[model samples]
Target: MRYIRSIYIFCSIVTSVRSGASELPEERELTTNFSSMSLTKVPEGLTPITTTLDLSYNLLFQLQHSDFRSLSKLKVLILCHNRIQELDIKTFEFNKELSYLDVSNNRLKSVTWFSLAGLRHLDLSFNDFDTLPISVETGNMSHLETLGLSGAKIQKSDFQKIAHLQLNTVLLGLRTLSHYEEGSLPILNTTRLHIVLPVNTNFWVLLHDGIKTSKILEVINIDQKSQFTSYESQQIPILENAKTSILLLNKVDLSWDDLFLIFQLVWHTSVEYFQIQHVTFGGKVYLDHNSFDYSNTVMRTIKLEHVHFRIFNIPQESIYLLFTKMDIENLTISDAQMPHMLFPMYPTRFQYLNFANNILTDDVFKKSIQLPHLKTLILKDNKLETLSLVSHFASNTSLRHLDLSENLLQHENDENCLWPETLVTMNLSFNKFADSVFGCLPRNIQILDLNSNKIQTVPKAITHLTSLRELNLAFNFLTDLPGCSHFRRLLVLNVEMNLILSSSLDFFQSCQEVKTLNAGRNPFRCTCELRDFIQLGKYSEGMMVGWSDSYICEYPLNLKGTQLKDVHLPEISCN
Candidate 1:
């Protein structure tokens, strides 16, 4: 037995040595819990290493040229959340193998080009960089791919230099600034720059410059929130500068006057996708008939969604040019009041019409619904008391996604409005529903918002909605929930302000697919009912982990205005 044991130990040792020799020896992945640790210059005992270092969340103030000389084969160096004031250019030079270097959340005032020649993915976001050093040239970095400089104060000159490079694919961030110089767009000859401009900066000059220089400039995204500072100006300079056929102008909140002026400029620009949003009328402030004329300009493809109109008095000539001359699809008009006569009688090519929150009754909708190829009809808050207008769209086979929220919906005519099984989303919130009236629902009701109603109990038949993903039942008097056990596909369930007991906690523990459970403002008995909540909070991917300080004990604990983690439930008693 002793001889056999010795042979076994010798064999084990031989196997271990052979395994270690066969392994491809490489440096270990650097990982340290330095988020709450104090440090100065790197960490101790990490010299002569070839590993990726993570010195984040350290209160490091300065790093000299020789601080990182030990990490010869380092690939990724993350120095984020540090108090770094200055970085030497020579410290990061000649590291050809280094790829990702994240120095975000630093106090860096400037970064020279010599410091970034070897990096491929650079993240210098949340830094206090105000100006670009002229020495830093994009042409020198021949292998750069992604560059993130968000929250850094940058000018248009920085973009112009980057555009001169031969980079075909890159990410440029310029989302924080008050102004940009004209002609600052990078002119890429062969590569496309995915530029993320500021949400409010107007890049009208950049678009024009691209059309003049870049032969491969294919996409331009001008969707941001900016009030028209210069109103009633000829758009010759903006429209004449379009090198790309696919242009997207999303959420351009121009005044009625500015919107018309821009429309006149881009009428014949041959843009395949043109979107305008938050458009409001000029309050009869400027009534010029020549400005609304469409004999000279025509939009072939346009989409006007969420256009706000305060003034209902649309002129006849303006309506004629918009509905008759222009070709549009997916036209959404929300939170606006238009005159009854302004409705289009015969549109040449319009596919979708969403007149949500308008001054149009059922009688007026019947007269104005005149699209031969209309696909979807969204008539929300037109004071619809019955389903009479739905008869007009029942035969229109293409109609889908009917939203009738915040309207008077009676329980008697639910069957009249239920037809096409292709309807995906139907919002019937803030309405009166009779008992067992939801049985005539379409098959594809994925998202249902039934908040702010007098429905006391949830009917068990609602579990038949197998495709429901999000169900909002807040602000109701629902004392019990029975059908939710079968709702396996529900992702978000909001049942706030309900009467729930401590025993009801076990019902939600096995909801495998439920990610968010908003049960705030409910009268929940403390005791062991909170045991499940406290236990489930430990799960990294479950509810209560994402919330900060919203959960409060209302009934048994009576500990209001306290965070869930800080609630001392031992003091809470049900007696």
Candidate 2:
């Protein structure tokens, strides 16, 4: 779900860049993110050279014409999740360089658009618009490539005005739609279409029309009703030459048969990436073995999140049937409450399997599940308590990345754990690990995250992981900073929020290869050792992050609450 939001934001930026603005240097673009600030009006003292301004999650009710008079170079403006009701035509007259504007989740009913000739991406979804906000007769939206509209009673005439405009993407928020005319969506010419279906609307009609023009179709169902009987009379449209290659369904409810019907619909089309989130499966807990065959389907990825079974106990047979037959290269079933994994009886070509946030234990591997081509396995937030079994189990497969974070993992014994030699990255954070965790880790591991554990110290006797590059040991109980005598190649080290009183210059000298270090939020003693550490940080630029707020002194009564950057000491103080 977080990735979905990131994709949306990334697409918004990409669309803005493709709308005629040349790519600017990373250092030249100044960005200000004021999201969730609870501001009622535009803040004062905004930089005039700012290129991106994010004011989302605020309480702004109106926008005055002089609000953005100083921002002449602003290209991206996000004012979503506000209470703005109206926009004066000249509100953005001074911001001629603005290319992307998002005012979604606002109370806007009408917008007078006169000065936004250069605007390329405009999102007005979740507003009170009953029809298209722009007037075809006078609006200057010729440069627009992306348009978002929602919470309206859409009619055939609504899109007739913009029928001639070829758009890159059309985002329709029909969750709050009052009425929708059949065949009203196909009139718009777009390469991608994203729609949020209302609970009671005829979604089939919208899907039938939307797939005709869109190469990528994303349909989100806000309805939680257990049955799809309302739209059963309408035949599910199938297109032999459908242009849609990507399909996404969110918050959908269906029975096993209805779910297969959806698969059957996409089987004939060109959908390659199919994703379903928060989907509930009802009816009997049975799946026909014959229907599970997807031999000719071109689907490459099938991701399911928060999948619920109406029955209390999941049918193991159904799970085996579906997973063994999907033939997809990547399968993700996170947060599905699955207790076990049963692989296909035959060899599988699965490259990635994510079963995170479930109740899987060590016993799941006892059956010798055959996933010979598995490369990445994410089992984070499960009920596993030991790593030896999982390590030895993956040693048989081609596993490379394993995430066992947020579990009850611990070094059950002193036996050295034998991990797959192919493993490169491992995440064991938020567990019950102690000093014994080192003996069980892979020797050749590169990236390791062991934060929020019970480890008190990094024992010098432990075997060093020479291949390690990035190590996160934050939120641990360590009293002293771990020296890089073990990880000489370490590039990034985070040991913040520890119980250290002071840092030694010897540690910095030992870990000279570290380019990034997060050793803040410690109770420093403000002594000569601390003074030398702070001086080293001052000279080595970009090494110590959060120096001002994170590296505050908490001892030596006079230096309490003072930042380490502000602390100064004389040479004779230690003598």
Candidate 3:
């Protein structure tokens, strides 16, 4: 579905460019990248037909009222990462088509919300505004959907005004609810609300008062784990609207009864996307698996990170039973030391599973490996040494991305040990493997990372990987290009910091589709042949032979420190 949308966008952009109505040559669609220049004003000569202008990373303390008046066709304007303290009234009035404005990370004490003809998204986060300038009256921002207020100490009244807009998404500050007034949360129609309440307050009181839970479908609560303390413990009855909300709790302290209490108060919120991460608890945390049952629920995703289920001291089967009922579309349980070996003989609805940083071994993986709809799997930083291809993953053609980096899969090489070879992206970096490690690599991988493996030579197995597009063999013991003429669609080739004394340009010329090749920091013999191979652009009749200008000579004392791009001379020819 995403690929189709990308194709649609590509076709639309191509049509727009060909028709000349989108970015006309006369429009000069983009100009002035005075970013991080510390300028005090908008760059000059910004044409009227300019559709996109960036004035970010500057020291402009104030925007002139008529600064953007001339750029009437401007649709996207970036003023983020600046020290702008003020925005003059009517500053963006004339840019009728301006739809996106980012003024984040600035010194905006207060902004007079005026007319921006077609404003749809506004990011004013990390500013100095304590009060919002939202008006109850319908203004040009009627179409505004996304409003970011993170790092801004929003005043209670100002927050009420901002809530009246019925925005689709709102990002509040870290401590937005610290001084929560009982009824500060206005009757908003926000579909998604993300905020972190400080630990010092009665969070239950704020949750009960500020928010009208009916309008919220997704809630992200981030607070320090130290802020949580065991309060009254009880099992509250579930509400009828149990499945309407998706909850995300990040870096929050969990009281024994807190999770159950939140589910009770929100009626399980009919949660479809539930993620609890970075949870902190003292001593052993108990889990009543009975409290979590999604058989009759529409649970889509369940991610539990750093929440010690091992400390529960529960039965291994009991832990598996907790996830048995969930028809999870995406599941991530990291650092919990889950007994994957105890998995049931049932398939999950999961399309994505990230069980990284666990005590997964060959035996555990064989018993736990369950995939039918799985597409992207992350098994990084585990103890698995070998993967069974014939008996397991080879049959799962649905898997596309596999990350087995930083694992103990070095000495586990075998003949029938092919991974989901058809995987599009494979990350096998940071593992203990030598030159023989190529036998286990997949064939149809498009993007392959074999960095930091101490590989002395290009894998003879690469000949089988004809579908390779991007290969990262950086920080290895490689000495030369591995005859990449077979990689017809290769785009990026990185072999930096290797032990290569000489490399052939003919190999790259065959893979002409490559646009980026980094062979820097390698010991290249700077002989006559090496000098002739360094030519690019006009030196090679507009052909990109040499990709990096940083490729310097490491041998031949006379030509030692000469850049590959600057070694053009009549004497340094094929002769």
Candidate 4:
């Protein structure tokens, strides 16, 4: 499964290279990343042409003007997670082109303003500033587009300096906030506002003010103390004036009524995306049909992660009814310890549903009805042991992408498997499948991931999958690569961490259409056949990933631990 992730990342890099979005050779060489080096002072002999420098997570306590004076082309500088106590105003005077600067998570009490007129993004969060470092009189920050501020206390006067700046984002980390003046956040003119609320504070005032002007609001760490009480009337007007399109709540505790109030509040607003994580719902309330009788919400997607229902005995049908009434097109509820999901009574507008990392079984679909519009269903990390039950459920829907990875599924020889005709991509990795698994697969599947399985061989009968493009068979017991004759259109193949001893020339000749191959981590015999395979990878250019590092010799005493790229063999030995 790790190799599968690497393959996808490699494909994305290839796509970026083709689109000319990747950095050029010269630009790549000008980047320096010295993070976590544990240095007390900046390294000497810094490249004069350096355009980006990262010195984060170090022991340095101070910065001098001479440290970065030579790097005149520096555009981005990161010094976060350091012990820096102060910065000299002339620290960045030489780097006139600098546009991004991060000095977060430092011990700085104050920083004498530098000539940062070119800076577009500045981060000073987690510092020792009681008030914001930037002031309205500091004309040097006129071009700033983003700002990060944090302190023990915040008041209306703290934001009076930057209220005129039309910014894109404002990140306020007030986890230790001991005091917050009302109407302080609404003074900022920003499109996105992210606030890490204090555990014990007046959260309603902060939320009410933050949501009034921002287009996207993200609030985190609201505990039980901040849960809705007798403030429903005040909260409704705040939500009604919300211009936010996305609202994210994290680490919040609420009751059933409070949760429903939030749903109803956001339904009439312009919010289209609502996500909640690490939330706990308390109260022993049983909801009925009338609870969800409101009109359809404007929300298109709703995601919940690591949420718990404490002391709540609500029926599963009622929970399903709540979401069905919202008319959400995409929904995800993973890592919530869900046991089963009964079929919804009414049709839902859900086009994508992810229910991973739960204990759901085949019975989840036993009473299921046709979901005509569902295009993607992710049931990974579940207790589904039967594959036919899922196939039957999907055949009646419009599912195109299905992920059943990290489950207890295995092939049953007696039962024939039939998949949806619309299904094109499927991930069955990290399961208990064997060689017989191929015969039951979807014939029209374009991308098949069967990695981390118990398969030993690719039967010749798999040739029926002519439409296959990408196949992952890593972490298996296969002795050799599967023949491309079985998948004529295959472009990417992963056979890493297997029991192969040698690579035959027949594989290279037959798999000419394969543009990317990951056949590393195999105990290869250092023979003429292996030598030819190494030569093929050398000349193919980007066709073989993790080449020398993942490809090492493990056979024949003298050649042990030698990389395939360094293996030597005379022409006479091969001929």
The lDDT leader among the candidates is 4
lDDT of each: 0.54, 0.77, 0.61, 0.77
TM-score of every model? 0.54, 0.71, 0.63, 0.75
How high is the lDDT of residue 411 in model 2?
88
Candidate 2 at residue 309, lDDT?
78
Worst 10 residues of 1 by lDDT: 1-10
Pairs that clash in candidate 4: none
Residue 447, model 3: Cα distance from true site in angstroms: 2.1
Q: What's the TM for model 4?
A: 0.75
Better of 2 and 4 by lDDT: 4
Per-residue CA lDDT of model 4 for 28-57, tens digit only, reads 437677777999999999988888787887
> What would the per-residue lDDT of candidate 1 be over residues 1-575, giving only the tens digit for each residue?
00101100111232233222124255354432334377876665564444456667688888776666766776666787788876565676645567767676667666655645666766665566555432445556666665545433445656666664555444334435555455555344433333345555665554555444432332223442333434344434434544444334433444455555556655555444445444444444343545554454334445454455554455644653454445465455555564332445554455666666766555554554455555566777766655435644544445555677777765553455445556666677776654344555655668877776666665555536778788777777776432455466878878776665443432565365777777666655555656556445545355742353545555554565555556544534622
TM-score leader = 4
Residue pairs with backbone atoms closer than 3 Å in model 2 (clashes)? none
How far out, in Å, is residue 569 in model 1?
38
TM-score of 3: 0.63
- lDDT for model 3, please: 0.61
Q: Please write out the lDDT profile of model 2 over residues 1-575, one tens digit for every residue.
A: 11332113323353343322134555567777777789999997899988988888899999987788999989888888899998665788789999988888788888876757888888887787777575663224778888888756877787887888878988886436667787787778788888876675556556656666587788877343423344555244556446777777787877665676567667666777777888887565343536444656777777889888775344666665576567677888889888887776777888888889988888787777677778898898899987787877887788888899998988865665788778889999999999888888888889999999998888777777899999999999988778888889999999999888877555867888888999899888888867778886778777897877898888899989988888888778876
Residues 1-575, model 3: lDDT tens digits? 01100000111232232323344455456543446687888876677877766677678887877688888888777787778887653688788888877776677776666766467767765566655445543234678776666432334565555554667766554333334444454444466665554454445644543335333433344332422234434444344423234566666565543554453354344566666777653234454646664435555676778865323344556555556445467777788775463444677666877888887776664544456777887888888766443226535547788888888766444545545645788888887777776666566779989888878875544446678899888889987765576567788888878887776676646767777677778877766656445654325453343445657777778778877666555672656
